[model samples]
Target chain A: MTPRARREALTGFLLILPWGLGFCAFTAGPMAISLVLSLTKWDILTAPHYVGLANFANLWHDPLFWMALRNTLAYTVLTVPLSLAGSLTLALLLNRRVPAVSVLRALFYLPELMPTVATAIIWTWLLNTHFGLLNYLLSRLGLPQVAWLESTTWALPSLVLMGLWTIGGNRMLIFLAGLQGIPEELHEAAALDGASRGRRLWHVTLPLLSPVIFFNFVLGVIASFQVFTPAYIVTNGGPADSTLVYVLYLYRNGFQYFQMGYAAAMAWVMLLLLLAFTWVQFRLMQRWVYYEGGATPG
Target chain B: MRSKWTSVLVMAALAGTMWTLGGGSPAQAQKVTTIRMVWQGEANELKLYQGLVSKFEQSHPDIRVNLETVVASSDPEYFQKVQVIAASGDYPDVIYGHYSWFPAALAKHFLLDIDPYLAKAGLAKSAYFPTAIQQFSDHGKLYALPRETSSIALYYNADMFKQAGLRTPNEYYAAGQWTWNTFLTVAKKLTRDSNGKSADQPGFNPNAIVQWGTVAPVNMPFGLFPVVYSFGGDVLDPTNTRCRLDRPAAVRGIAFLQDLLLKQHAGILPSQAQQTNLFANGKIGMMASGYWDIVVTGSAIKTFAWDVAPLPKGTIQSTRVATGAYAIPAKAPHPDQAWTLIRFLSQPDNTMELAHLGLIIPALRAAALSPEFLAPGKVPLHRKVFVDALAYGRLDPRTTHWAEMVDTLGSEMDLVWTGQKSPAAATGEACAKIDALLQH
Candidate 1:
């Protein structure tokens, strides 16, 4: 390479050095260590002893591990689709040329801005059995009050209901962008062809938005699978471990129980599962996720 | 020439920075050591601690302190924060922690053995409550200087009892009629629906009940285990090598609580137990909590009258005692300074300052028994019950596997609380799990 070319490349490399060093030290470094520790019994306090695949073998029999996995899977399944549809609906409404549309968009996105801890705290009062606003409203509607959090049957679902609070967040914004990106001519053509608005949405708008939906779907599954904070702050995997998500259990093993090896194994398992889920989604994408251009994958 | 001058200037600046960081000068006498002392508390407590630290700094000019606060909702969470900090090789000079993490901390040798320091300070074990010192020790070697001791008691709303024409818990205890049965009866009377039907009365709608009789001791150790002990049950066998919670006595104790929760519907679920100002709102007639709540809940209550009473007699009168203390990390960079800070914090005067907030029963025996702590004309009117409790109070089960055992028990207990599983079955399953943890 020419001296000038080499110099320019060197300068570019120097510019990214800070971030590169940070990624290695903070992220990659710990990850590599955790991978090693996953094969050992390290409690952060004591010296770790290499135990081969013992932690993984233990996880195979750990009832709580399976329970946490089931709970997290249930949460992800419930959250992702509902969130996808909810965000898409909000995006559709926000995509309209209504007056003060920006204000409407901001209002819809406000819940996402609140800190997770604050949201969890607020929801505790909102879901209080007797004095809760939800129960009070239910009573007014001539319905029996539901124990939103106290009962095991309802605790997980209550968390899922909370998960809906984030539907109008970034996912909606992305959907809005996708809605805007849909060619205006298609809608005009559909209308000219005497297709109803609903038909136009289903046939044209939805098809074009499919790729965005797919993107958000993949992201939502990964995000929801790692749900931790609300569960930690609110129920804390309680009312009978109903709200015990994967990460929460992993955290308990690592931090609370001081079984770092077990927690690390759980983390790796989660990473593998998430990768598999995403890969499967990609494998299934050809059937539904439409590409407007001819650059669609096999 | 300019580049060489810049390099020289850089070297001078670096030297100056190093010199300032290295205690100003090498020849300086009475070099100050800034010890990092980690602590956690609420806003008021933190403010008070800041004042106390300032006072300590004024008195010990040679010893500076960098007070670090770790915000945690629970003691175990605090332990995790310190453990993470230590794991990063940035061990704090001191940590003010609770007994909940004692076994784990002691097992890992995370704490410096304060017995030697206490000897150097000429402090005797008899100066503190025996339980306080015992909780901080293992095999007679103390690892922490006790800051405060706490005991659980029954907090009852007096107006509710008076309006119901029933004697208060303290009155019952005075007459020796304060067993679990009478406690349940009183709770039933205190509990009322919007239509004024108490739990015992006909046509009382459990669904629409506005007032709860009690917050169930469904919460761990402090809340429930005391009742277990009072019922002549033990959490662990004498050797601390096996789980005893599945024994008949323990099962009966748990069954009693389950009855209060499910059958009578007099007790709120433990999940619903500590709702924001529930007891303070006059909606809860009785609640089981530690002495710490005197400030936490009492300060919020202006519309109601309340007082402390010893927990109702089960098979025998019992309560849970626990302590919080300031411990030096084993690898502390400034161990001697940390000890000095701990000694300063645990002084009779400083402990009195801490106790005045009504947040703790000072672990210092003299300070705790003083008139200031037992405040005769206080609104609670029964502050001594906490001190009295310490006499019969049992410490929480001592096990290095505290977290795992408690989690196992808590998960099973939750099912019992929700009426999904019988107390007997749940405890049986819990013991099975806890036993596995014990064996390891």
Candidate 2:
């Protein structure tokens, strides 16, 4: 390579050195240690004896492990598409050039800025069985009041319902950005062809918005799968372990139950599952997700 | 371009040096030793400890305490954070912990033996409550110095009883009529609907009740076990090797609590947001909680007279006993200094000063029995009941799996409380889990 090119390359490498070092030390280092620890029986205080795949073997028989995994899967499946649709609808409504649009956008994004703990606290007050606002409204509608967080049947669903509180949060903001990126010319052309607004949206906006939807769907799935704070702060995985999501159970094993190696195994399983999910999502994307640059003539 | 690159390299070195200097300043050119003490307490308790720590520092000019206050909602959370801290290989010189935490910490050999220090200091074993001392000792060695002892007792609202025209719980106790059946009868009388009907009244509405009878005692050691014990049942057999909660006596206790909540509609689960601290709010007749709640709940009531009473008799009157204590970690950086802090903290005068906070019944016998603790003309005029309970109080069954066992049982108990499972079914399931835990 020429001297100038080599110098430029060296500068680029130097610029990324700090991040590279951090990624290795904090991320890669722990991942390596946790992988090895997963094969042992360490209780944090004692020496870890090699236990082969005993932890994973035990996981096959552990009821709580399966319960947590099922709860998390159900939560993710329920939350992702619902949140995506809700946020996209919100984004569509807010994308118009209305007066005070910036203010409206900021208000919609406010819940995302609030801390998770604060959101959990507010949701608890909203979901209280006898005196909460939701039950009060339900009673007004001549419906029987639901014990939102206290009943096994309703606890997990209540969490899913509360999660809709963030539909106008960051996911909506991303969709708004994606909507703004779509050229106005396409909509105008469709209108010129006498296509109705709904037709234009179906044929033009949706095709262009498919990429953003995929992005948000994947992120929403991952985030929902790792749900912990609300479950921990509110029901505490109860009314018979109905809300025991995977991460909270993993935390219990690692920190509370003195089963660090088992927790590490659980963590690895979660990672592998997430990886597989993302890979499948990427493969499926070719069918629906449209990229302007990738749409080449056959 | 060369000068720009040179300046960038210089800046990188400068940042590196500053980072190193910032983190490396703890140890310096001085003879003074700073021993870290990890503690968990509410704001007032924290203030009390800070005052004591400052006084200790003043007396021992060479020793400085770097106090680390851990904010935890429960003892298990405190232990969890401490365990994580220890696993990181940065051990605190001293740790303030509870009896429930002792078994797990001891199982891991994470605590220092304190018996030798006690002997060297000429501290007599009989100076504290036997149960308090017994809880901290294992395998013929004391691992922690007892700090404060506690037991669950009934706290009743006297104004509610007066308004209901029912005799107060203390009066019932005085008349030897305070058995579980009597307690239930009184509870039914005390519980009121918004329509001014008591729980037992023909037209009373359980759904629209404005006042509850008691805040249910359905927690671990302090709440649930006492009821189980009072019903003449055991959580585990004496050897602590197998679960016995499925036995008839325990089932009877569990069934009694379920019936009160569901069928009788007299009690409400503790920690329900709408029902929380109902005793303090003057919306409940009675509550069963630890001595610590004397201050926690006592300070909140403004409209009613409330007082302590012994837990009503079941087959027998029994309460679970527990203690909080201070110990030096096995790998403490300054064990000698930690011991000095513990010794100063546990001195009779010092312990008595802490007891005045009303959060703890000082483990020091002389201080506990003193009028300061009894607090004559106090809101809870029956302070002596807490002291009396020490006579019959049962320590939680010793086990290395205390946290896991309690959790296993608690989850099942939740189903029973919700009327989803019978007490027999819940206990049977809990035992199935706990029995396996015991084998581990």
Candidate 3:
């Protein structure tokens, strides 16, 4: 390489040095240490003993581990599709050229801005069986009251509802962008071919929106698998461990029980699951994802 | 020349920063032994502790205390922070820990033996209540000094009893009719549906309860232990190496509570926050709560009248006693100064002051039984119940596997609470789990 080009390259590297160092120090360093620790029997108070894959072996027999995984998968399965649909619907609604559209968007996005702790605290009162506003409203409408937070059957669904409420802020914006990016010519042609409004939406709009859906679907799955704060704050994995999601169980093992090695093993298992899911989605993308230009999938 | 000058200036600045960072303030010439103390609690309790710390510092001029607070939501979270501190080797010289925490701390070797200091200070085994000292010790080694002692009692709302035309718990206690049977009867009488039908009356709806008879102690140690003891049951065997929760007595105790919460529908299984404020809010007629609630109930109950009575007798009369203790970490730098502070805090005078402030039942024997704590107040008209409870109080089961055992059993107890599993099946599983954990 020429000296001038090398000098320019060196300047660019220097400008990015702080970020690169931070990525290595905080992210890579801890991850590497965690990988090593996952193979040991460490309880924090004493020196860690190299126990090979004993920690992972223990996970096979741990009932709570299976419960946590089941809870996490249930939450992800329920919330991801619901959130995507809710956000997409809101995005389509807010994308209209109506007066105060920006204000309406802002108002819909407000729930996402509230802190997780505050949300959990507010929901406790809102979901209280007898005294909550929710039951009061149901009573006014001549409907039977439901115990949203207390019953084992309703706790997970209640949290999923809360998760759905907060999706409009980020996911809806992406869907809105995807909606706007769809070529108007395709819709015009479909209409000219005597297609109905529903037909045009089905054939043109939805096909174009598939790429955005796939992207948001992958992101939502990963985020939903790591649900912790609401469970930690509100239900505390109870009524009967019904809401003990994967990350909350991992947290209990590491921090509460002082089983850092066991927690690390749980983390690695979760990482493997996420990787497998992503790879499967990538392969599946070929079947449904459509591109804007010649035979390329967005 | 300019480049060389800049390099020299930068080096000088870096050296100056290092020097300042590594050294103490220049004006503090005298060596002061700073005792690092850590505690977890609500803000008001921490402030009360801060006042005590300031007084201790004034009395002992050569030592300064650095206070650190961990605001945690629950006991497990608080212990997690303590374990993290110890693991990271940044543990405070002094720590405030619950009695139940000693077993885990002892197993980890994170606690210091304070018996030597106790002996030197002429505080013998008889200095504090024997049970308080017992709870703070493991294998005959005192690891901590009891900050205060507490026991659970029956706190009843007088207006509710009057409105229901039922005899008060205190009246029953005086009349020698305060057994589990009568307790259940009164509880049913006090429990009313929205349409004013009592739990006993036909057509009563449990789902639409307007007033609950009592607050059920779902799975708390303080809530469950006393009843278990009253039924002649023990949580652990004498060796503390196995679970006795599957025993008949314990099963009966658990069954009674489960029936109250689920079948009889006379008691409300509320959350911790709700239970704390229930009796004070006049939504519940009685509560099985610790002595610490005196202050909270006193301050919050403006429209209601409340008083305490001895817990109803089951097969026997027993209550659960709990205490928080001040302890030193095994590797504390200033053990001597930490001991001095602990001793000062546990002194009769200091203990009495804390009692007068309605913070605790002083652990010191003389102070605990004194008029300050036992004196009747307008709110809790029967303050003697808590003091009398100590006679039959049993400390929580202490073992190296306390946290794990409690957690496992608590999860199973939740099953019973939610009516998914019977008490026999759930407690059986809990006992098996505890046995396995203890064996490990």
Instruction: DockQ each candidate and list the results.
Output: 0.73, 0.58, 0.51
The 10-residue segment with the lowest total lDDT in model 2 chain B: B269-278
User: Which regions in candidate 1 have their CA more than 4 angstroms from the true location?
Assistant: A1-11, B1-27
Pairs in clash, predicted candidate 2: none
lDDT of 3 at B67: 85
Model 3: what TM-score? Answer: 0.92
lDDT of 2: 0.89
Candidates 2 and 3 compared: the better one by lDDT is: 2
Question: lDDT per residue, candidate 3, B251-287, as tens digits?
Answer: 9989998899889999876573372366777888888
Query: RMSD of each candidate?
Result: 3.3, 3.9, 3.8
For candidate 1, give the lDDT: 0.89
List per-prediction Cα lDDT, in the order shown.
0.89, 0.89, 0.85
Q: What is the descending TM-score order?
A: 1, 2, 3
Error of 2 at B269 (Å): 1.7
Candidate numbers, best DockQ first, in rank order: 1, 2, 3
Error of 1 at B378 (Å): 1.5
Candidate 2 lDDT tens digits, B122-207 = 99989989999999998779999999999889998889899999898888999999999998999999888989899998999988
